[model samples]
Target: MRDLTSTEEFHELAANSPVVFMFTAGWCPDCRVIDPIMPEVESTFSDYTFVSVNRDAFIDLCIEKDIYGIPSFLAYANGSESGRLVSKDRKTQEEIEAFLSNLSK
Candidate 1:
């Protein structure tokens, strides 16, 4: 997964490709829990570009996207949102896979 650098980069990538912005924080335990499974998830969903957004580094972006949780996922394609799994809950690998799988519907 790629680390998000700036708001501009976020928008640019989202507008251009199928991008999944994963909102997370270094101090968040739930975020750490998902870290181990991310590589597998990313590999499975190879069509989407995974970008890790640090909550602390992009608080304004999180607020704008209505993301009030760590380790949330926001998927975008063709300059618009395609799907999202935004919540304060701990997400399982199954749940994450389900979310991504259902995006096209």
Candidate 2:
């Protein structure tokens, strides 16, 4: 997963292709819990471009998008939002996979 560098980059990526932005932060335990499984998840859903966005660095963007949670996922396809799995709860691998799977439908 690529780390988000700038807000401009976020917009450019979202507009260009199927992208999944993962909102996370260093201090978030829930975010770290899924770190080990992320590589596998990315491979399982190879069609989408995965990005890691630090909640601290992009607080403004988070507020704009109404993301009041850590370890959230926002998917974009064809320049529009397709789905989201936003919450303050810890996400299991199955749940993450299910969310991505549902996005395809």
Q: Count the backbone clashes (under 3 Å) in each candidate.
A: 0, 0
lDDT of all predictions: 0.93, 0.95
- Candidate 1 residue pairs in clash (backbone atoms < 3 Å): none
| lDDT tens digits by residue: candidate 2, 6-78 | 9999999899989999999999999999999999999999999999999999999999998999899999998
Q: What tens-digit string does per-residue lDDT give for candidate 1 at 1-105?
A: 999999999999988999999999989999999999999999999999999999999999999999998789999988899999999899999999999999862
**Inter-residue clash pairs, candidate 2:** none
Model 2's lDDT to the true fold? 0.95
TM-score of each: 0.97, 0.97
- Name model 1 segments beyond 4 Å from true: none
